[model samples]
Target: MTSSDLWDAETAERYDESSAFMFAPDVLDPAVDFLADLAGDGAALELAIGTGRVAIPLAARGVAVIGIELSQPMADQLRRKRSDIPVVVGDMASTAVPGTFSLVYLVWNGLGNLRTQSEQVACFRNAARHLAPGGRFVIELWVPGIRRFPPGQEAVPFHVGAHHVGFDTYDMTTQQGTSHHYRRHPDGSVTYGASNFRYVWPAECDLMAQLAGLELERRVADWTGEPFTTDSESHVSVWRRPEPPSRPLEAPAGA
Candidate 1:
C-alpha cells in the first residue's frame, strides 16, 4: 500500500462529517445486514476499515468484527466511537492478525486504495490467509466509468451539489484515477481534496481471487443484492476459500 494514500489527521477528523450520506440507513443498513448474514455466528475481518463506519453497526448486530487500517488517524477516529473493536494499523495487503475468520471484507472501493495491481493481488491473498476453510472474502468496488468519457475527455463529474463538487480523472493507460473534491464553506471559502487510486475491472478481481485460491461465489450490483447487469456502476462480489479435502478412511486396526 502507498503511504501517501493514508488519510491524515485532518481528513480523519472530518471523514464522517464529509461523507455523512454513506451513514444513512438507506445506504448503511443493507451493508451491515449483508455482512452479518455472511458472518453467521463467526467473526468477520474488515480491510481498510476506516473510522468504523460499517464495522460499528455490524458489530452492534452481534457479529464479532476486527479491522485492519492503514491510517492511524482513521483508526483513532474509530476508537473514539467504540473501544472494543480491535484495529491493526498496517497495510491491508500484507497485515497479519491472529486467528482466522468466516468472512473478510473490503468495502467502499478500498481495494482501489492499494494503487498497484500487485498490491491488490497481495491483498486478496492476505484475505485468503486470514479466512477459515470455506470462508468468504467480499469487496465492494466501482466499475470504471470510462464509458462516460467522450473522445479526449479524461475527467467525469460524479457529484455536483450545493456545497460540493466532485470529479474523477482517469488515465486509461495506467488504470489510475484521482477523485477531486471542492467543498464550499458557509463563509464562501472553498477547500480542495483529492485521492488517488487504481481502478480495476471485475474480471481482473476474479483472476486475483483465483490466484489466491478462492472461487467466485457471487456478484451483485450493491449490498442490496441487485443483479449485476452490464450497466451497473458498482459491484459487491464474494469469493470463498475451498474447504480442505477430507482424508481417506483408514483400515480398522491396520488390517
Candidate 2:
C-alpha cells in the first residue's frame, strides 16, 4: 500500500486541523447526544475512533467509551487530549476489543475506509460481536451524490475554497471513489492528499447488517432525528441485535 493509502503518523498529525468542520460543536453535539442517550448506563465502543473526537466528549458526559483505532498516531492525538478513554490499537474491521457494549458507533463515514464490501460487512459483524443483546451499532454516512455527476463524467467537485480544493472521482463499474484534496499554502506551494472509499447505499448497508445478525432499527436524515428522504444528503443509521427470546414459563405438572 502507498503511504497515502494508510493514515500514517504524518497524516494523523493534521487530521484534526484539516477536518475542523467535523469538530464544530454545532455538528458534533447532536451526534454525541444521540449516542449518549442510546448508551444509557451501558458502555459504548467506537470503531476507528480517530483522535477521540466524539468518544472523549461522550465520556465527559458519563458514558463509558472504548475505542479501537488502526492508526497509533491518531490514537496518540487522542491520548494527548485525554487519557481516560481506553483505546486499543487495531483495525476496526476485525479487532476484538474486550467486553460487550450497549453501543458501537462508527461516524463520519469511517466505514468507507474499508474500501470493499466484504470488509465493510465484517466491520458490521465485528460491531455485532462487541454489542450486548439489544444493543446498537450506529453509522453516519453520506449518500452518494450521483446527481452532481455529468454525463460520461466520473468526477465532481465537492469543495472549493480560498485555500483548498476538494473533489471526488468515481469508478461506477466498481463503486470505488477517490476523494482528492489540495491545500494551497502561503508560500504558493500545494499539498495533495487522497482517500479511497467504496460507497454503500442504505439498502446495501441494511443487508450487511442482516448478515451480521442485526436489524435496522431506524435511519434518520441526520442526528436530530429528521426523517430520511430522497433529498437527504446524509444519514445516521442505527442497527440493533435482537435481544434473546425469553423461555416460556412451564406450569406445574397436572396443575
Candidate 3:
C-alpha cells in the first residue's frame, strides 16, 4: 500500500480528464458552496488538493484558500488555472503548511489515502494543527461497507460506465482497500490505475479527531446538510477545534 504521494505523474496527468464529471457545475456547486459558507471570509486549507477541482471553485467564491499536495504533477495541473493560492508540496499526514486557517478540509476520499491507522491519526493531528480557535475541519468519506466482503470474495464493483469502470478490493484483516480505475479511450485503448487506502468507520474517525483536540460539530449525507442516515452511502463530517483553554478558577482566599 502506498501513501498519499501515490498520485504519480502519469496518474496526475490523466486525473483531471478522467474525473472530469466531478467538476460539473451540478456536482461541484454544492461542495464549493458548503465550504465557502463555512470559510466566511477566513482562509481555508485543503489537504490533498488534487488539481484544484474543489479549491479552484471555492477560491472563486471569495474564500482565500491554500492547499497541500504530495503529488507535484497534480499540483502542477492546478498551477495552470490559478497561482495566487499557495500550494505546499508535501504529505498531508504530517507536513505543516504555513498559517492558521478558519477551516481545513479533506474531500473526495483523500483521507483514506493514508493506508494505516497511525498515518490516519497523524492526518487528524495535522488538521488540528492548522486550525485556529473555533476553526473547523471537514472530511468527506464513504462509510465502510467492508463487511459485505463475505468469505473469499474481495473485490466489489462500485462503478461501471461506458468509458470507465472501477472497483475496490478489501483486505478485511488490515482494513485496507485498493481502489482500481480503468478508462477506455476512443482509439480503442484502456489505461488502468490503482491506489491504496484505509477504510474508516465514522465512529473511529470521530475518536481520531477527538485525540487531535477536535470535536464533531455536524455530519451530513452530502453538502446540502441532509441528515446522515444508515442508508447513506457517504458523509460530510465537520469537526471543530475548541476555544483555547479557559483559566482555571481560583479559590476565594487562594486555597
Candidate 4:
C-alpha cells in the first residue's frame, strides 16, 4: 500500500543489487539502439531512473539524459557513479523540470511503479508536458493477459542464477502477483523474499498515452523492432507527441 516501499532510498539502494542484470541490454540492446535513433539531436528525460543503469550508457553515448527518481538514495547512488547526468529527486507523476526534452524513457515496467490507475494516468500526462515538439516517449512494459488465459493459472518459474531460482505467482481476480526469490548464499544460508503487484497490459498503456495527447508511433515485440504478435510476451511501445500546430491562430473580430 506504500509507494515508498517500492521506491524511496532504502529500496533504491538494494534494488540494483537484488535485481542485477534483470534488464540486460544484451537481450535489450536492439531496443536501446532503436530508442537512440529516435533521440536525434536532443536531450532525454528518464523516469524512475534507478541507479542510472540505462541513463549512464545513454549519457555516455553523447545523449543528454536527465533522470527523475523518487528515491534520493537512488539519485545519490547514480551521482556516485557519474555526475555528468543530472537527476532530479522526485516522483515522476508530479515532478516538473523546466524545459522540454526530445525523448523521455521509462523502462523495466517502471510505469507499474505508480501502483494506481490515476497515478499512471498522471505519469502519462507529465510525460506529455515535458516533451518538445515532435518528441517521443518510449516505454518497456509487460503485455499482460498472457499469464491467465485458461483461468486459475498461476505460478511461473524464473531462473535467476545457477543456484538461485524463483517463482512468480498471480491472482486471477486482482491481477496482482508475487515474485519470490530464493537465493542460496555461500554461507549455507538461504534468502527468501517476495514482492507483489498488478500487471498492466500494452493496450491499456496505448490508451493511456492516447488520452494524454500522444500518438503511438510503433510497438515492437522487442528492442530490435520485431513485429509484435500474439506469441510475444512483452513489448516496447513508442509514442510521439502531437506535432506543433500548423499555423498561428487568427484573432477574432476586435471589439
Please give each candidate's TM-score.
0.97, 0.95, 0.93, 0.87
Candidate 4 lDDT, 68-171, residue by residue in tens: 98877888889999987888988888899878999999987788667667778888999999999899999888766454445555667755575578877766
For model 2, which pairs clash?
Answer: none
- Quick one: best lDDT, which candidate? 1
TM-score ranking from best to worst?
Answer: 1, 2, 3, 4
Q: Provide the lowest-lDDT 10-residue window in model 2.
A: 1-10
Q: Mind giving the per-residue lDDT tens digits that candidate 1 earns over 1-255?
A: 353397899999999988988899999999999999999999999999999999999999999999999999999999999999999999999999999999999999999998889899999999999999999999999999999999988689988999899999998899889999999888999999999999999999999999999999999999999999999999999999999999999889959
Write the residue-wise lDDT of candidate 3 on 1-255 in tens digits: 336546678878878888888888887899999999899979999999989999998998889999999888889989988988789988898889888999999998888988889999999999999999999999999887665676788688778999999999887788888889888999989988787888998999999999999999999999878899988888999999999889998879956
Stretches of model 1 off by over 4 angstroms after superposition: 1-4, 253-255
Per-model lDDT: 0.95, 0.91, 0.89, 0.80
Clashing pairs in 3: none
Q: lDDT tens digits, residues 227-251, model 2?
A: 9999998899999999999999999
User: Which is superior by TM-score, 3 or 4?
Assistant: 3
User: Better model by lDDT, 2 or 4?
Assistant: 2
Q: What is the Å distance of residue 153 in model 2 from its true position? A: 2.2
For every model in order, what is the number of clashing pairs? 0, 0, 0, 1
